[model samples]
Target: MASTEETKTAQVRIQLTTRYPDIELPDDPGPLLVSTGFRRYALSTLVNNLLQTERPVPFEFLINGQFLRTSIDEFLTANGISAETTLTVEYVRALIPPLHVSSYEHDDWISSVDVLSGSSPAVREAEEVSSGQERILSGGYDGLFRMWNMSNEVIATSNAPDEGGHTLAIKSVKFISPQKIASSSMDRTIRVWDYSEESATLTPTLELYGHKSSVDSIAVHSQSSRILSSSSDRSVGLWTTKKSEAPSAPENLIPKARNKRRKLSHPTPSKTGTQRGPLSLLTGHTDVVSSAIFSPTDHTVGYSASWDHTIRTWDLTTSACVDTRTTAHPLLSLAAMNGANLLAAGTSARHITMIDPRASATTIAAMTLRGHTNGVVSLAADPDSPYGLVSGSHDGTCRVWDIRSVRPGVGEVGGGQVGESVYVIPREILKEKGKSKAPVGGEGLKVFGVCWDKHVGIVSVGEDKRVQVNKAGDIIRT
Candidate 1:
């Protein structure tokens, strides 16, 4: 029976062909006829050898009885077969499997947000208090001085008493104490206000009058009761608080500039009475002094940027000029950072210059920023990120710049390589669609101020009569 079965099986022979014309089968039938117990095993071996025969496998297939299917071409491709290359398998199992693929989708909006209010009517100046809360004192064209309670929702607005006066438009306001506020106005006087404990309301305490011109700016000493005010009269005046007393005669009001040759000349009364005197007269600039700020780190030192196209550092104790730099154009605003060592000034020329007060008073013109098409009106620095700065421009936009990589050059105070920008907030340009139903002459937005609150993020005020609060580039509230 065994002899009859072996004769009936009669050595099954097979020949394989591939799409690669160079691959060939061996001429010797001895190796081909070696009886591997499984017919599929012998077929798989032949297919793998054909794939490795120095020719690429255009396609792969498996054959068993009358069925044919594709195989996974691992031996040929090693990594995996791709769409461009076809793979085939040859096998004796009577069936083949189908090829399969898989399919996938991304998101748009920002993930999280934190919102806080900006100073209303556009904050003219903002200062961070030691308590981690911000003291943002703002002046409005409406002749009001408002103090925003950043810790609460409702902002406290207060007006100085009329005091036989009319329509006092506040031009500048500064915080002297938690209980006291000082403001300068078109009224040509500096009024100090005392706040009620719980009500957060302000009442006029005293009206100081020495500036011959309208007081344009005010700065207070962090440690002392003294106050400094700059005026359009081209002068900076220092004031000290005093208690009221009974009225007295106005005598000795003129000065006696006498000659030695003249005998026994009567002295003229001094024009400036004992009521006030400027500690020192800073007279370098020929134009109106616009802004003056005391260094937050050093009480004895301060800086002033003026419409005279110059910035000067002054020693408050001696009232002497320490350093000065002349701008190509009139400066509109000024900011000092890193303990007043690095100074930034914005000009009417639409350029921003960085300076080092301790170094030579030369402006680092190469470090100028030219993004704003209109004049830069204000600038603020991040409390946590010293290199991060936010600027508001008349072009109706606010931009954030990261200047962490900027470094000063050798022997140059503020002369350093320009930094790369990490973020920028573009101006929201409004498009006028058509003539129908549109207001006669209404233009779009105009940004008046931009400020960064440690607790609040970035806040911007515009001429559109809106205050926009943004956190991480997205407008959280308007």
Candidate 2:
């Protein structure tokens, strides 16, 4: 007996195209007989199957110029696509380096999961607590510190004068602990906030004032209870999480020295008024200190960058500069790689330089990364990735870089170098009243701060007066 079995298949026509106008595709591939019950399948599979390529690299898919993230059958029905209707799927290359070294393939770096905007002032600095992903803290030029969550809602904000808030612009913010956060300000003070999750309260607990000028940046120890702050006073100050026992004492200001001086003194009481001073002071730079960050591996070592065009390594315990290297440009930001034996810094000239911590002590930068058209303002190492890093710049963009794939500087022809950006924050058009406004250049959206979470989620605050949350997708290896 001959039994005839019937096969059920759905038909779809795949079209390969790109966003660029000049990118022309080959002839349209014919129909594909796919299973109707298909749930989740790789977009590369469909592209390769239709293109007749033996191997295919990763690419994002769109249906009729609309981006699609689901399986073929589901995407077909949800969009009211019929089996007889040809599915116009377009593909675009993944911009980031195929992360092959990290045992994971990285995606979603080109786009953000959420864009948050409420306040109108540009954010100057921001921080995300790695232990908890919900809370995000940001400082703005409006002299405000705001806290928000994943829902694009402002959780709490410090805009009131009665809450022990800053009377001037907040410069930087860092988490002292999971429950406590500290912020430095242009007002020459650092305010510690006690945040409560259960009651949804974040209020100032105490204030620390030591720097004679505006405090620009701050760093917190990973394994200890210490905090490091840099200031326009051209000095780095070290303090602790403990509040001062005496509140009414005045600052015993240090005498101005002409030569390089590294000294540690007990936190002197403020002479101008009752305030907390730095427990130890590190002075060497001839100009404003832009950034200071603790080594991820060693808590005792701190790195500080300054407008003096030099990066100095500090022995926090001895209050001495162990090493210093002059840079080609004024260094503005820094990030310490935990285990790769490397560190990165952003410069005023729009360059990001990666150096061997052991080798940077005596020589020039090992390699320079070029991408942002404007000065780089912030840098952050991906905590989960072995060689991944992120940078924010005055060009109004955030880019991810992989140390393993950085092009060597052998092609320098004019005593200068050039590099490419892997992924860029896509330019979006503002939509109002059901009509899309003309696209505006990102020059006004200068990124001031960027941070990564334990899950590799990215959050960036920019001069656009916006906060963006970037959540990565599966690591798809080509």
Candidate 3:
């Protein structure tokens, strides 16, 4: 019998295939024998050699929907795969990993982040500028929401506590328009602000008070001026940014008991705007509703993810919950991938689950992405591609994922296959002062929120009180 090394080096048969329209291989090439010792780089070289192109193109290989991160021999042994079986591998253009660009410091933990650039609703497409106009909106545990320019200067900040600003830690923030913003907080309310870029000022315009408990997150639809909020009270509230469009608060919906306001150093601005209420309350979640967002393709359709381990689809026009898909772990964050007709949910189990919320979808889940070492707390869909996604986790790392590269789950989760991240982005040390010098994987490094802007790249906030920016590489369309 041959030695262990020789047996491990034995060749295996593999069928090469690609879904990419541009890349093609010889028809009926049959199976090609390759050493089981081949890793990703070696396999990539093989493909480039076959193509015989002037310049070698890097490619990523996928077997069974999972990336080929290890040598063929190691992977086969670990999965108990037999060499006699012909493995079909899919190849696609490799994505360049995003590099750390810059970071902004905060007084306390940053909870949520969003970037506003020329692509925002208020900014006309014709007047849209790539640089200088980019603004960053961040909410923090310090009970203040701030607006920063591309130069990392604080252009505007929320009003004083007495002036209708958040009385407690802000949980979420979003730009309703270039001139307006909406924020939700543990103070049991949502607040909209009027921002003046010329004067670099932020003013409290409206106070939305109706949630019985802390408001966890908020999403905005600028076209319809609609806002969706998820709360600890287990309900999703619907409202409009335009004051005149919303109705009065119903007496029955407001709770009899309320959270006591916390005292602050600055005198509150004396409640500047009219207090408004939600147009409708969609209730069904048995636990805290962590996130809510309107469908990208249809404004009337909405979805909410809750700690109850379920994602509920709603008919917003009727204020009805149309369907619910249960998962194995509590969901902490959610993002819409309408281009792909899917919703991605970040879970406490340290993985992101992609669900097919469409009524005609045969399975509850399309696939599961596994990589994060801690709870996945935030998710942002790549604005350029439906299959592209990024997730922030308590493990102090952000992972970029391509849902298309996935493998079958073999029946562990209902209707769930599995995949791994395309790139792993880690927290970087800021060269500027007042930044954390904590080592990689240090404590108190949990990433709380993340958002991907087409113009500004990826922005993520974490317990380290830093708003980190990473410049994503150009997409190599295959």
Which one is best on TM-score? 3
Error of 2 at 463 (Å): 1.5
TM-scores for all predictions: 0.56, 0.65, 0.82
Please provide, for model 2 over 1-478, each residue's C-alpha lDDT reduced to its tens digit, 9 standing for 90 to 100. 1112211244355545654433334565455555544332455666656556665656655565334555666666655767666655556544343221111111112111111222101111353333334556667776776666655566766645444677677778766655677788787777777777677677776667678888888887624667889899999988776665423313444322233365554553323233555678899999999898887777788989888988898999899998887877888888888767766889888888776678434446766778777888788777556556788877776788755444336764223223455566532222222434222334555677787654436667665566665655664321
Candidate 1 per-residue lDDT over residues 44-148, each given as its tens digit: 556556446463223223322112221122222223334233223332211111111100000111101112223321122452234434444555545665555
Q: Which of 2 and 3 is ahead in TM-score?
A: 3
Output the lDDT of residue 237, model 2: 85
Query: Could you give the candidate ranking by TM-score, starting with the highest?
Result: 3, 2, 1
Name the best candidate (by lDDT): 3
What's the lDDT for candidate 1?
Answer: 0.51
Candidate 2 local distance difference test against the native: 0.63
Ranking by lDDT: 3, 2, 1
lDDT of 3: 0.84
Worst 10 residues of 2 by lDDT: 102-111
Residue 337 of model 1 has an lDDT of 68
| lDDT, each prediction | 0.51, 0.63, 0.84
